[model samples]
Target: MIRKSFYMLWGTQTVSNIADIVYTLSLVTLVFTQSGSLLTTIFIPLFRMLSKMISGLVAPLIMSRLRLTSILMGSQLGQFVIFTGLIFYLWLSPEVSYPIIFLAVFGMSFLDGWTDPARNALIPRLAEDEGLMKANGLMSVSDQVVKCSGWALSGVIVAVIGAIPTMWIASVSYFLAMFFTAFIRDPYAAAGVQAADKVSSAASGAGDVARKPSYGEQLSEGWKILATNRRIRTLAIVDNIDTLGGAAWLGAFILAFVVEVLHQDASWWGFMNTVFFIGSIAGGVFIVARVKKLQKNAYLWMLFSLLAYVIITFFFAFNNVPMLALILFAVSGLPVQIAGIIRRTLIQQNLTPAETPSAMSALSVLSNFTFAIAMLLLSWIADRYGMRDMYVVAGVMTTAAVVIGFVYRSAFREESSPAYASEENVAVNKA
Candidate 1:
């Protein structure tokens, strides 16, 4: 039954992911064709990303009141309704206003933001500790596969059908996503029962009413968890620093590197992006295949990945040869992807099911917020010091993460206490 629930959750997100890509492509095409302004088209993604960041910031408030499955289902249903309305507005209005289109986009994106943390939080509950690594690996592989092909497929889709029809496809997809989300069983019932038992025990005391935590306290829950938990805090710090450094791979910087350093044309830029995704997919496959062996040394695997990132990124900064750069780019994706899966698994193992949603929400906000700032910082570095220097800076930042990971190495190690350990992570103390 748990396995079935996991698959349902998986299917729900997969369908929604395809819809999101298709919808974005269609919306971009619609905006460009209507306004014929590059800046206007650019604002679509800008608005969507910013709204998601805002949503992530506020998701904890809703998570406190709603189950993860409810949040997931509601988010998808909201997206469906908004997209359907947007489609209708576009069809009815002979001239659609950019503001109206962007408003609808923002609404949908705001709702969409809750889905990720909810999905991630739900995974451990459905899969349990024994299956957590495989669950994460499966999700990672599906995500990479969708990302690897979604854009290209959606591009072709938008090209064939008009933007409106393509959007209708997305609307239908969103509805189906919501449908699948509805079937996901609540995995927190056992936790709820445990809480009830505690409440009853407390109520047995005369004239003792347990005070519920205040809203402010609940709002700060995830942040408090990160602040108080050294293991999770260390991981969060490394994750954010990695995110900042990883911004070197932003399209603008990569395009600059391809043109100026590799001396390749725009097509090669596209090829490099494609190869990056392919490498990530391959990395996911590698991890999934070796899950049992790798699970025992998850922390070590993460350290290895960071070391690989430090080396590959530094070499990648200097290489003028396009072929060698391609090889380096492809190889670089492996460790990073592996590290991502392992890191996520470790965090899942370390947190209780109830804490996962809020923690994931907090992490999501930090990551998106960091990426936004990193883009600006990396862009400046690329402009002032040249693109090669930008990547070198990236390497330097990741090197700090490696140093910190080594310093806090014990935090990720296996513990005899199952309270902080999972079956797969039990042997990671060898790190």
Candidate 2:
């Protein structure tokens, strides 16, 4: 099952991520060609942010209706159609209409959100125990390879050939992905099984999945779980801290720093981004390898996260030297990757399947909400102080994580949690 699922997942992700990279690079190139405004360039990513929330909401419904394999294949097929339609729209388009193109991109992003979780959930469906983390790591590995290779190559293609062919290449990749997905069976294919399980759980009062939820119920339940569940809330907060501490701010700061501090071109965005990317690649692999080893000191992963952010904050704060700052930022990637996998694996494995999507979504919603709020605050600080000064504020927020981790370290290290223990083994496995 692992072998079959591995091939299926690899094919599914490789093509999908590659297609996305092409589309994005193409879109930016198209916008720059058409409008010649950096704001339009920025809005592309901003609008697509909606897709994350969309994915969080869609994951449960997609999983509920279709099996994991079916969901995976269906998503790939939808991407194919979306890209084809986008091409048609472009062909029909006399001018580059931002709204229509944005819609196409947003629509694709909407599907992307659900695609990831469903694909992720399928890991446990395919393999369990120690292998679960390994499977996720492999998925990340494929994702990184595609993301890196596609973005790098697409740039050259867009420069030489133009955005139109890039979009076509993207569309073709989706179809190929769809073809690969079609070959695999949904490991959790039977909606009937899920339905029956829901019924059984509801009957036994295990946990209800059948009752229709009001939007408020969905919203409130999200908070209730996070607030009351010590482990869940703590991890979510730490994760949120990591994201909110600097991601949205980093791009601007790094860009400014590379030019002003490093005395490099405005073009160093690619190099800086690649540095971060390389860090993530290394970090993701480390997570897969080290998650089990850190089972006892899982809280230490949060420390790693805090340390990374603090380093990032400090790296950017007073530094006029771009190369050193870039190096520090690259070094920061390891902990961020470690913290990400640790948090995701713990959350997904701990929650029941029914709760998985909501919990994941809820956590993400918080991350988004906080980042937006922090962006405004950081912008204000940048206005009042300077870009580098914002790092000081972020540095403080980053260190807060260390304090939070110490507070919740006990919860993270709870081997009694169902995730860390098999039903057959109730005793904590202290190595």
RMSD of each: 3.4, 4.1
Give the Cα lDDT of each candidate: 0.83, 0.69
Stretches off by above 4 angstroms in model 2 are: 1-3, 184-224, 416-431
Compared with the true structure, what per-residue lDDT tens digits does model 1 show for residues 1-431? 13689999989989999999999999999999988999999999999999999999889888877778889988998899888998999999988888989999899999999988998888878876447777888888889889889998888888888899999989999999988988899767567445434544554575666555567766787887788666778888999998889999877788889999998998888788888888898888888788778877787889889889899999999899999998888888788899998888877777765567788899999899999999999999988989989999999998998889889987755352232243233333322
Clashing pairs for predicted structure model 1, backbone only: none
- Among the numbered candidates, top lDDT falls to 1
The 10-residue segment with the lowest total lDDT in model 1: 422-431
TM-scores of all predicted structures: 0.93, 0.85
Candidate 2 worst ten-residue window by lDDT: 422-431
